[model samples]
Target: DQQVKQNSPSLSVQEGRISILNCDYTNSMFDYFLWYKKYPAEGPTFLISISSIKDKNEDGRFTVFLNKSAKHLSLHIVPSQPGDSAVYFCAAGKYSGAGSYQLTFGKGTKLSVIP
Candidate 1:
């Protein structure tokens, strides 16, 4: 079963507009979460993260918000630029004991920013 899901396979936004990416998880044990952005050939790069303890986290033009009760999260990019166009993955993590952590990832959503 898929623990995390990105309902929208793709999204498009105009340059200088706001882009909102959504994610949902079925696992309640997830205590930490992260977002990753991947280019065509490079590896997925860490974008932003939010812990269960906090509802929101922001970095520069990127912000992530968590709604624990709804088992949902979202990433908002202000003035979405062309460089921000990429595949975004939502990852949820939990402590599996023995100093090990486990993660579950969504398929990813392709974001396109129009010039």
Candidate 2:
């Protein structure tokens, strides 16, 4: 069972507030972790990623923290805006033979930004 789990299906936050989304995994072999943000009807776009070798990664308003010991990870958005409203998906993968990347994604967490 290669299921990545996002416990909360939805989250709401006021504009300029901080938003945090959580995810958990059962597989211990997963080495690469990625976060994607998606708008309605469109494919998810890569937001940020962190490897199992590191504990944290950040980009502008977004930061992702990983706790290997807990088999959990979270994405944090600072000063959330209306444009931040979208579904966030957490994915995990490891390099296999033939150089192909196979990803297992969470159900997704819908973030509603109230402006």
State the TM-score for model 1: 0.98
TM-scores of the candidates are 0.98, 0.95
lDDT of 1 by residue, 1-115 (tens): 9999999999999999999999999999999999999999999999999999999999999999999999999999998999999999999999999999988999999999999
The list of candidate 2 runs beyond 4 A from truth reads: none
Task: After superposing candidate 1 on the true structure, give the runs of residues whose Cα lies further than 4 Å from its correct spot.
Answer: none
Clashes of 1: 0
> lDDT score, residue 87, model 2?
98
Question: Which is the leading candidate under TM-score?
Answer: 1
The per-model lDDT (C-alpha) reads: 0.97, 0.95
lDDT (10s digit) by residue, model 2, range 2-81: 47999999999999999999999998888989999999999999999999999999999999999999999999999899
